[model samples]
Target: MSQQLIQGNEACARGALAAGCTFFAGYPISPSSEIAELLARELPPRGSVFIQMEDEIASMGAVLGASLGGRRAMTATSGPGFTLMQEHLGYASLAEIPCVVVDVMRGGPSTGLPTSPAQGDVMQARWGSHGDRATIALAPGNVQEVYSLTIEAFRLAETLRTPVAVLYDEVIGHMREGVVLHEPTPEELGRRTAPRAAFSPTFLPYEPDENGVAMLPDFGRGYRFHVTGLMHDERGYPTSDHVKVAELLERLERKVEPAVAAVPPERYRLEDASVVLVAYGIVARTARAAVDLLRREGIRAGLLRTRLLWPLPAPALTEVSSSAELVVVAEMNRGQWALEVERLAGGKTVLAPYLKAGGSVITAEELAGHVRRLAREGVAVS
Candidate 1:
């Protein structure tokens, strides 16, 4: 293990390298440019490929191409660039091309904030692209988690045969922290499942194994197959068959279900508490601190910091919130994820939101005060 003080963006870049990523394609964007910058400096020296594409769309295309060619590929961008890559992201989902995308979230609908931090991209990461597809998104609250989760993103992408997203706010992306970087063991560095039999005309490239994941072959491995954005059959050819299309979508979502358990939420002080706070990314750091402050005030407040953003972690969330009288979903956005919590929450618990958008972070003092007032009044605080 090696300890060093490094920026979260730099940690993400290093994590990519540690995950055996050999190709990177991205356009420089604020809050996320450091990732591309660091990879450009480090990748070539390590005999890996790094390219600055003309735009986010092209960058995603290049990454898909590289991944198909049997390379661990990735890209990094902020909100605006991430929007442009949505089309390609959808394609990757349907085609089952394993890749990683790092979104160092700023604020946005359209370039809302360049340098400031925000958690507005939570919903976008899961639903920005068209169609009904499953998404695997990881949120890291600190620099150390940024490094570790970046590697986990690649591991999930490879093993599940899908694109994985690593999301963190600008605060975590640029914040400096002392991180103990550990090299992943062989088991930690998962491999993409390959076809068991020799490729031939009868081979179905999209045929799923017992795990519901398709064994996709590398492009130049003499396994000729189609790769398209349209719904595909077992042979990887375009298909409009209603049964096959429905099955494809169902299988796509079912295969990624393992991620819910793979990346569980961090339950803090929730053992016996009446008030529960929920948060993720940089906001989770503040929420954790707020729990301590509330506890000191005899508020019996606890926290549920989620690292896995997608697939909802419904079971864990339901179990935790069920025991609490109040569940406060705090975030640095206009209640994006709070909506999900509301949906999953039982009727017994009162759900409140602590939302602050426009690039400002939710402070511990602010969150603790809200919880304190809510506890006294026995009502939801906006």
Candidate 2:
């Protein structure tokens, strides 16, 4: 490992290469374009392919196709571009293609801010794709975590044979930090296990092998199969039968839920604290600073920083919720994770939110003050 000052987007691009990514397809978007720009220069000399697609949709589609063709593939975009990629995101989910999508989130409903920081896309990262489907999203607080989590995102995509989204705020994406980026070992690279070419007529394309996930066959590998956006059967054909649709849905959920459970929770100073602060991404960095300030002020405050966002780190958050008198969710968005903690806490504890949106990053002092006021008056900052 070598310590170097690197920006998060550059780290993400390097992480993709370390994960054995062979294809990059994306349109340049702010706060994320660096990932594309870096990869564009790095990949070709690496015996990999880099493509600038016409739009986000095409970029995503090309990435899915690349993955299906047995290449580890990825695409990067921001809020507006992420919105445009949702349809293909849905397609990747239903088709069971393995790819990684990086969303360096900015302020948004649409074009809210192009060059500023915001964590407003938490819910969108999970449910932006139209139907009921399972998704994996990872958020990293700093450049180092961004590098590691980007590798983890690709690993999860290949291991679970599903598309995984890496969510980071604009602040983290553009900011530089000192990072030790170790080269991945062969095992750590996590290349997909290629399935044997199905030459027999009886080969079932989508039939799962006990893990609730089907082995993905490389394109042109003599495997005959259909890939579509519709609800598919074990053979990958479009199926509208109620029973088949229900079964497919359950299988998809089963494949993803276990991976979420297997991700280790990250806890800080929560072992003996009464007030627990919960956060993720760059916002979590501020929340950590606030925890230190609160402890210095003689308040028993701790932090539950979650890197995995889609699964919501419910068990860990709920554990903290159960022990704490109050749980404060600090974010760059207006109460996205706060609402989730409220639902998971379920009357066990009071949930407070310190939220900011539209490119405003919440300050450490503001969060510490919120914790102090809550401890003194038993109230959330409004």
Candidate 3:
């Protein structure tokens, strides 16, 4: 292990290189621009390809194309650019292209703040793309996790044959921390599943294995198949047949279900607590501190910090919520993910939200104050 102080965005770039990513295409965007900049400086030296595209849409298109050509590819951007890439995100989901997307979140909805931090993109990461599709989004609370989760994002993308997103706020993206950067072992660096049988005219490029991921052959690898944003059949050809379309969508979702366990939530001091706080990304650090403050004040507070955003870690959430009398969902947004927690929360637990926006992070003192008020007044904290 090599220990050094590094910024979160720089750690993400190094993680991608460690994961064997050989291609990158992205547009310059605040907070996330460092990721693209670092990759540009490092990739070419390692014989990898890096390009600054015209825009986010073109960047995503180039990434998908590179992945199809058998290169481990990725791109990085912020809220505005992320919005532009939604169309390609949907296409990648339906087409089963393996790539990584890093979203270093800044204030949003329309270039609200470039240098400030906010978690406004939480819901967008999962639902920005149209239609019913599964999403794999990882949230790292610190610089070390930024490195680890970035590598995990690429691993999941390859094994599941889908795009995986790495999300963090501007604070996390730019903050520097001491971390031991470890190289991934061969097994840790997962490989995409390739076609098992010899390629022939009868080959089915979209046919799934028992794991539900298709054996997609790389382009120029003597395997030819159709690729489109429309619903596709087992042979990778466009198919509007109702049964095939329905099955395709269902399989797309079902295949990624294993991610729930593969990337489980971090349960902290939840073994026997009456108050539980839920948070992720940079807010999670503050929330954890609030838990300690509450515990010291005789509040029996615990925290559930999720590393994986999508596929929601429902069971873990429900189990913790069931045992708690109060569940506080703290975030750096206008109650985006809190809505999901409210839906999954146990019927017996009282849920409260501590939300902040306008490019400010939820501070530990502020969160603890809100929880103190909520615990005493039994009213929701606005």
Candidate 4:
């Protein structure tokens, strides 16, 4: 439990250790490879497992496999690797496995920039895995956040009995900043409760207690419950019945939505604003700096820094945007998460996209200029 200057990637690895992650399976890719390198060396000594699979596909498969074995598991990857993991992600979602996936987004439609930073995968992290099932994700704005959010990811996964994503840009993924490493406090929240006892001769996997989070039984713990990606009933048996599918999906979503009440993030400063910038990850941090400069210049602009990217936090954003005359979204990628914001905000708000491609950072100076230019021209973002 100490603070030190560390890279975001290292913070993520250390955060995993603190979050009770005992298994990691990853494929080396830019931006996120450092997390793997550090964990490979760090985890074994701590009685954890680190695996580098042949590719991102197997990397994802291994983590899911390990999670079933009663270990807190994780995986890290960049955009390409993340893209490849979509199928397994869907599997993790449907199977209701508890684990974390950290995606350090680099610029890309496909390998657009390896060593650069981008927030291109914001939408993908939420919906890239094909399904109607809700996925939760967190976007960290700094190195310390990478540490904190990784723990949150696992906590959400275990509590909801679902896979969760920790979203980061290459900048936050690689940038060196101060981080406080420590074990999560009991009051900090954590994993879902497992079954007190193993299954009987007839075991049911989909049976959930009052909260709707099914008790996850550890594989080979004398528990013989069958798990499959197909839609299943409370008995864990494949159910083609319409009522079974409807009920299963409803339970999956309900388990997560209730947990959001405990994971509120900073609003930055949207208290009384005419114009606001909605941002996440590194761009949000830079945008925070930009907002300060705007305030100093007497502009009533504010920032909405999202800690929770998925589940979208619609209620909070709607409340913040309601006070704004216009909302500008800054991201390293072209309006990915911004689109989601727009959908949630409806048409009551103006929209401007400060988008960048390839690999780069959206500096405070650049954002300040954008705010000034738009304000001077009286051009509402649309």
Write the residue-wise lDDT of candidate 2 on 37-115 in tens digits: 9999999998899999999999998999898889999999998999999999888888889999999998887888888
Question: Candidate 4's residue-wise lDDT over 1-382, tens digit each?
Answer: 6679999999999899888889999999998999999999988998889988999999889999999988889999999999999999889888899889999988888978888888888878878877785788888888998988888888888878888888888888878987778779854537566776566866677788788888868788777778999898877788799988988888877777854565576776677777788888888888999889988888887888878877878877787667688888898887787787788788877777788766888988898888889888886432
Q: Which prediction has more favorable lDDT, 1 or 2?
A: 1
Model 4 residue 76 lDDT? 94
Best by lDDT: 1
Q: How does each model score on lDDT?
A: 0.91, 0.85, 0.90, 0.84
**Candidate 1 local lDDT, 265-342, one digit each (tens):** 999998887888999998888899999998887788889999998978898779866888889899988889999988
Ranking by TM-score: 1, 3, 2, 4
Could you give the C-alpha RMSD of every candidate to the true structure, in order shown? 1.5, 1.9, 1.7, 2.0
Clashing pairs in 4: 158-192, 274-325, 351-381, 351-382
TM-score of each: 0.98, 0.96, 0.98, 0.95
> Cα lDDT for residue 63, model 4?
95
Residue pairs with colliding backbones in model 1 are none
Poorly placed runs, candidate 4 (over 4 Å): 187-189, 196-198, 379-382
Model 4 lDDT-worst window of ten: 258-267
Question: Model 1: how far is 119 from its true place, Å?
Answer: 0.3
lDDT for predicted candidate 4 compared with the true structure:
0.84
Q: List model 3 lDDT by residue over 283-343, tens digit each.
A: 9999999989988887888899999889788898888778888888898889988898888
* Candidate 4 to truth, TM: 0.95
Model 2 clashing residue pairs (backbone)? none
